[model samples]
Target: MTKSLKTLLQTMPKPLFGMGAALGLLLFLMVGIAGGFWLFDRYNSPPLGILESLSEEVLDRDGNLLRAFTTDEDRWRLKADLDAVDPEFIDILLAYEDKRFFSHHGIDPLAVLRASWQLLSNREIISGASTISMQLARLIEPREKRTFTAKFWQMARAIQLEQRMSKREILSAYLTLAPYGGNLEGIRAASLAYFAKEPTDLSLEQAALLVALPQSPEARRPDLYPDRARRARDKVLERMAQSGTIAQSEVARASGHPLSAKRHDMPQLAAHTADRLRRQAPKDSVHQTTLNADLQQRMEAVVRDGADRLGTRLSAALVLADAKTGDILAEVGSPDYVSPARSGWIDMSRALRSPGSALKPFIYGLAFEEGLVRSQTIITDQPVNFSGYRPKNFDMDYQGDVSIHDALLLSLNVPAVALLDAVGPARLMERLRSGGVTTELPEGGDVGLAIGLGGLGITLKDLTQLYTTFANRGHSTILTDQPRSSAERQADASASPIPVLDPVASWHVSGILKDASPPRGAPNLPIAYKTGTSYGYRDAWSVGFDGRYVIGVWVGRADNSAVPGITGRTAAAPILFEAFSRSGLSLSPLPSKPYGAQEQTLAELPPTLRRFEISKSWLTNDSLPEPAPKIDYPPRGAQIEMTRTASGQVLPVLVKLQDGRPPFRWLVNGKVLQANGNRRKVAWQPSGAGLSTLTVIDSAGRADSVSIYLTLP
Candidate 1:
């Protein structure tokens, strides 16, 4: 009752009346505007609207660029309107969402009034009586937030849409726009995802399941809530029967039917393959990958089953190709894959890892084909110390004086390194790159030995592709997974021979490599293979070819850490054998050629070395051939020594046969030794490490003949 309070009341009264009047006027204007828009939209909106856009593209396996797109995402959307929806689903959806749909127009005034009365009575808004048109409107114009304003817009849009399109069109839009579950935006995606078939292909029970999903897609995911979904499906059947949408027996059959939703457990094999393809075709728009469902499943089964038996933390990768065409047939990346329900990470295919000695055969074969060295050439197997790089033979022992054939057969590191040195790392790396190896080679000059030893990192895809050259007779071809046609067949048949390398040389190298891998118990089918072991046992690989298929198997831990004590022969060869065995190739032997097949000589031999000719009987015998004896010469001179091969013992006799007269002088520790009385004998003692030598002197004072000892340990 103070003066300020009285003044505030007076100020509030005058404006309050005016404000109320203005508010009433604004409400009236809004209602009038809304009403006019509704009437105009309902009466004037176009009927039988023309199609706006549509297109579809079909691609060949090579991504050879085919077709144009229609309506963005739907190249193959065969629309099934309301009349086409399996009658059971329509009944379930109508019974659950809107029992009065058929009885109402675009909006149900009674349901709206009922909803308002419930809200006024403080009851939860458990049900929405949106007619089919309203549902279609919400689908066409999705909103970020669900508010009263959104419902108002939906109602207005519904009336306009109903005038513009037929009931069938509205229902079709709803079916496609309806959200079912993850990756299932519409009835079609859900139908295929859950039932492994299309909407038209769904069974009665499946149709019920789809219709039940709109209530709660996640809570009733067929994969997650089989029981709940089944019960909801039964309710749908009952409602259909009660509503006379279907006969009593029909309802009984559907309600009592089992919910046979196809098992949606992530297909381990397919998912793994898709992951690999995704990596390979990241920007390819569409990935027409070479994945044979049957082959992939078989490979998965083998890897999973084999890993279990091996007792090691084992995993495997398998790639199959058409040997003639270089087309990949199948690929399995891993045993485990990513999924909403699963909890592990494994990307086995593209995971870069070391492919130990697996690269050896290709390298050695390429070297041989290039004529860097011959198979029979005597490559020293003795310990080699080149600069600071010293590689050891696998046995940790050197085999001295081995033929190149023996060295390669044993995969002796020194012989391979020697060949690499002869071929030059740069040239060899270029050959590998040309053969399809997309890997980083070690610095050619610095780490040439490392590359020779399989120290480079490479992905399984590239590794497999590189081996295709060997399988394809040293020709590179584009590999893919699309379907082949008769025209393509004729083109390939008429295509020119793949040009790159000498067929004879490549085949010879391949033959040698094939023999090198002597299968342990049962010989692996006539396979030309090379195995590799990287430092720290970080990787193991066995890439080879049977008569028809080229195989590459790489095994290692996923973390890029070393698998202690595992080598390529141990880890990957067995898997290769298994794959080859399953492929039905026989263990037949390949043709063999003589060592140094390209190099042989029939020319006359070089002249023999004999500095002095001598005879016996100087002391005892009466008759003997006289010796062209030795002569003394310069004060400081070199001496010749001869020794036998078996024992390091020196011989005392000098030979008469020589290119010219012997000018050799005999010297023992700086003193001139006299030729014996027989003239044939010269005093020579064992010296140096193994054997001694006798020197013969000629009239010119030049040493005529010297023979050095070659002792065998």
Candidate 2:
């Protein structure tokens, strides 16, 4: 309104002030909108979506795949890391998918501008602006709709992911989540299925195919659309060459290679063991076992081939373990896991069955430990009876007198039972139980003499564990199929060794068995072994060991049905020797004789051990004199009543005696009752119901008699 204001207005144009006001409003609105967008991105962004689920794999000790299970979504989503992948494949993937992947935080602004320019100029989408991180975000939180909203959300998630994870982690997620057709969800699964190998050792062509398949998995599946897959793979190679990521020569070679026309089945070795370990380790995605892949394969083949020749319904199981460490080297549960006729699904090694003569060595080992008998002591193999139970030789024949070594090597039942009776069955069972072997007696049945002749139930696994003691110099340990953790190893290192047998006793048994005859046509293996055939041939077993390893073989039917011709020496011993041969280890020599172990001849043994004798006080040394004989029934002057038998005849009067020198003579009414003087208990038929005299005299000419009046009922 003043003179100065009038002069300024006269200098300025009328259109200029109005245009300036409009420009200032536009600048204010633009700044306000940008500030609002920044607040929304900072506080309201979606989750990063980086923790994708993966498949669980079971591997051998060397990390070779034994089996793989699908992810929760039924997809083979094996985990992959950038370091574990082929460097060439990573390079090709980066060059083809996102060249500025490392330089950009998540979304590349320059790429977005270029793509926008192309879309506007050519009216078509030419190249994607999404970096690898952006692509990975979309994969993790997939949305089917290709709307602008979904694109914006994915970009936001990508930026968040980049901020949380390193570049290698981003690339790893991309490699892991990328689809490769038909439920195959990762680079590792794709490489294994298509090329039957690991991604770490992928060929150039294989790498390119894997790199390109994720772009259009269904349309470019190598198994279904080979031509399309080949084209896509070659296009990736061409791009790689153009970008100087790979040599031109490499591109040519890779392009010339043919695409895989079909997918391959995944590796499925050690199926039973893998399944067991997976169940035990549910939370672990990778289960590593102590199994040796090559040895397991060879042993499986050996069992299958052996089972084939053993006839129908017959199966075989073998377990090989490291003697010192108790780590199971190879375990074949059955010859053929899928054979229905053989009942192969059953793991026979764990099945409870009688172990026939396989237990004889333990009996003899216990006897030796008790000093009741030596390996060379003479034992009477003549027919013998305990009360009414008579144990006969397997052949129904007898050797008059044989050394204890012959009795054990021949698996003579009567002598073994006699020794068991002297030592007591309860004592023997306690020894086996204390050594980490489980022995199952009949339902509600107490330990009896028959158990010495395979009358109890025992599994091959426990039997093998017991045998390991001899190979381990009387030390016992449990066998493990899983790799020990650091804590477990430390615990084992500090634990005390379990004693199964005295070193001298174990050596004595092993020394005797090692000289036993081998199966016909087989070499005399340096290993010590024992054979066992159950009653009715229901189970045949052979367990052998050297200094380092113990191998046990069982051949039988799972149903417990007897095979007529099956016997340990014939059906199982040969397999035992062959298994040791295929173990791929040199034979280890047996342990040297322990100090204070007496390896004496038969004549050099003490007077008591010079000949095997069964007595209640039999455990005493030769220096002790024999106890005096005493009649158990009918005191010096007592009345006795005799009962009638089932056939309505007068039952015999049974006389029992205890503790006397051998060849004790029995006399009734001053007449000799029988010719045999060694009888401990004699049954005499009463001639008449009157006062009778029962007299027994020891070989030392000592006499003791009881008089009783008997009334027959």
Candidate 3:
């Protein structure tokens, strides 16, 4: 301590030292206030428990509502955001609930002062000073009673919320958690329930009514007390007009609007689809599907109508899809969703059922691709045994020899089985699997000719996909229920493409089936379709396609029981045509012929293709040799009478042959009645009633002739 230093310190004023101590104390106090605020904010943060209880929604491709599941508490707490609500509703809310909602941090002092003054001057609590943020705080941390303590806590939490979140966030929270009436929490839920629409497009009157409901949810419930709700809504309109939130004339018009008398039922279209999607998505998340609600409704109607006409215990499933994109446009799992008699709850579209003759087209297509047969190629439809496993046609009779086009158009069983044998069943199964179809073969059973006739099990969805590949020019893509995102689409584009069949083969099959006669009385459609009836009539199916769309239909007893007289041509083909008609799309023509394809008649085809020949070894080594030529009909020297009707129609004589090679020639009275007859039977129109000689010649040069006298009736 130097003497100079001591003198300088002693000259300092006592007031200056006192001021320094006061400043130090003020700095400490400031630090303490900030520390207390930080601690309070950390402890008083808004709870987000309400957000976890939001309702889950399933939407269509256009974001239209499909279905929504309520919270565990049975509350309709659909998620809401500031952008999703009508601006008019927000305006009315702020003007009526808290005018200074945007400018004030959390609490409005002027509003508090005004409320306090009114309470004191009137000796009653007439108005509330709680801003929207304060209300949000109370909503998140609900309290049973409105006490001074609760109000103070709410104000503190609101201040903390204002510091932590943006104005829009706070407003969204309020909109999402606000109560409307029983079991309706958010604006979206209330809007859907009361008005049967979205909150994003509400009228002024609807907006006012929604704004008023949150103030006194129970007392102002429109469904329970329409008059009280009208009054509350008008009060909101009055405030909105006074605050200039809306024009006075608009207010008058809004006030004159009526309140909703009852709640509306939520959207229930595509209920099964929504349920399936919800099971696959995360809880409380939104799911969007590629289903078209309108199309789905129409398909359901079609299936239901078909099922009704088919009688009891019968169900129908249908699927419609975009051929190019493989997007499932509509799916009907069953005709009626609640009919126990029909087992309607089961999703039959995904169920494994025998496809019957529905698969014959693919076999024929494969044959065409292999160059083993053509549309104009002649095929034998006579009774034939393959290793002792004989296949009989549905009618228990065969047209002895027919062109490939006629065979496929008639859906002949023998020709299809013979073709399947030629193409090898294993190859057909492999082709189907490569095309994204799942075929269920019997355990350890070899691929056999029966598979060509639908011995194997396949779902309608997979079958539809397989047919869609034909419409898509023989390329196959996976079908999707939901629209893919851009990234997913890109990834799919990078994946290797799957080829189902050659383009020419697919086109040939489509061309042949397109000309097949439609079901009786069905309007002619430029579509390629096939009908199938499984063994014992257990399942009936019809799959059809054009250039743009493919539809598959299944009708049967869900229990796999046989339904008598239920064949594909009768029960399913009509439904298939009706489905196309109800789809509301113009019929698309079949794709243009592939470059290598050329239409020709059987006589114009090459010699080898003019007749389908399989080696005796392919059939069986135990088979007997070709029988000598013989004529069984117009038996040797028998008199046959030719009849003419009143309309002057001449009747023909029937010529039948047995145990002979094909390409047989017939002669009547030395005049050739038929040249190169390929069947066991032929009809000859008698020129006159006289002695007629019928002669038959086999391709091997063996000849048999029967002469008979034709007498006029």
Candidate with maximal TM-score: 3
1-713: candidate 2 lDDT, tens digit per residue: 99999999999866755777899989989988678757766887644433446788877778777678888878898888667789988877888888888899999999899999999999999987888998888888899998889988888778878877899988987888899999998898998899888888788888889988998999999999999999999999898888888899999998999777989987766766776777787778888877787788888888887776666557888888887877787888888888897788788878889998898888898898899899889988864547646665655456878999999999998789888897888888877876677788878877898888889998777788788888877776667778887788656534535466788999999999899888986788899999998875578999999988888899988888655446788888888888877778788998889988988898799898999875533333546566577775545676654544334566466576655676878889999887555656567888979999999888877778888888753
> Per-residue CA lDDT of candidate 1, range 1-713, in tens?
99999998988745555777999999999999989996867665533222222222222243221222224554332234455456657766777676776666678898899888887787678457687778777755668998999898888787777666676677777676676755455675576567754465567667777887876777877677788888878877777777787688977887777665454432234455454445665544344544555555566565555444433344556666665666666665654444211121565666677665556655566566665545555556754555545566654456777655667778888667666765667666666666544666545535466677776777776777666655556654444455557677456434434333455556656666777654465454667777776765556777777545676776665655433345678667777677766654444333344343453221221222111111121121324333343322111132322222223333332222221133344555446665422233233334443433445555544454344442311
Among residues 3 or more apart in sequence or in different chains, the pairs in candidate 3 whose N, CA or C atoms overlap within 3 Å are: none
For model 1, the stretches where C-alpha displacement exceeds 4 angstroms are 1-134, 139-173, 176-185, 188-201, 215-255, 260-288, 292-348, 351-354, 371-390, 397-409, 442-450, 478-500, 512-528, 547-549, 558-560, 579-713
For model 2, state the Cα shift of residue 234 in Å. Answer: 3.1
Root-mean-square deviation (CA) per prediction: 19.5, 13.8, 13.7
Worst 10 residues of 2 by lDDT: 615-624
lDDT minimum window of 10 residues, candidate 3: 640-649
- Residue 53's lDDT within candidate 1 is 23
Error of 3 at 601 (Å): 2.6
**TM-scores for every candidate against the unseen true structure:** 0.54, 0.77, 0.79
Predicted candidate 3 versus true structure: per-residue lDDT over 373-458, tens digit per residue: 88888887866777766666765457888889999988898889899988999999988987777889877867888898888999
User: In model 1, how many backbone clashes occur?
Assistant: 26
Q: What does the lDDT read for residue 703 in candidate 3? A: 88
CA shift at 280, candidate 3, in angstroms? 3.4
